[model samples]
Target: DAGITQSPRHKVTETGTPVTLRCHQTENHRYMYWYRQDPGHGLRLIHYSYGVKDTDKGEVSDGYSVSRSKTEDFLLTLESATSSQTSVYFCAISRDEAYEQYFGPGTRLTVT
Candidate 1:
């Protein structure tokens, strides 16, 4: 697997605790993305990085944030983990705009 690794594969937390999930990639892909999978939203983007120091938010970036300091590392932080934020976080990468992506296993976060 030349992709990301999310620590704490599964987590159970109460409302209002800040949680930080990491995405470590082995591939040197330039474009990295973070997304959350939910019932109706399917997979909505949280944040993404175009290059080492260039990052941007996506459609559903609220309540979430991201950072990418190297070619193979991207981190997503939930300032305040809440019950409504319970979902699976996935990290993906695309070498080029026309290429397909590779997604990490997933991090299941449950906030009670």
Candidate 2:
């Protein structure tokens, strides 16, 4: 209802598996971001895109990748996920920096 949704709200897998998380949005804002919130590290940026075909890596982009071919969709892929990657992932969008960000319900990933 907040203009966005995340798929596979909960996932559990082995230490070596590929995972892909999907973020779907109704508001065609110019900015979208993926962040992981761990126990104490707080929200760490993973990747973000300013517009279609325009993207950049964030602080925690290791083993992760993202794509935004359209304004309404963004995807985050973990190439060979590992146990250390276990965290709650969140997708957020902003039309302007001054306004509040709308966040999608998180995806919890657990690797054993």
Best by lDDT: 2
Output the lDDT of residue 7, model 1: 76
Q: For candidate 1, lDDT tens digit of each residue in 26-109?
A: 888898989999988789988988888889999988899888888888889999988889999898998975688889989999
Give candidate 1's error at residue 87 in angstroms: 0.4
Residue 2 Cα positional deviation in candidate 1, in Å, after optimal superposition: 3.9
TM-score of each: 0.92, 0.94
The number of the candidate with the highest TM-score is 2
Which residue pairs overlap in candidate 1's backbone?
none
TM-score between candidate 2 and the true structure: 0.94
User: Tens digit of lDDT per residue, candidate 2, span 1-112?
Assistant: 6789999899998887889999989998888999999988989999998898888999999999999989988899998989899999999998965667889999999988
Question: Residue-pair clashes per candidate, as listed?
Answer: 0, 0
What lDDT would each prediction earn against the true structure? 0.87, 0.91
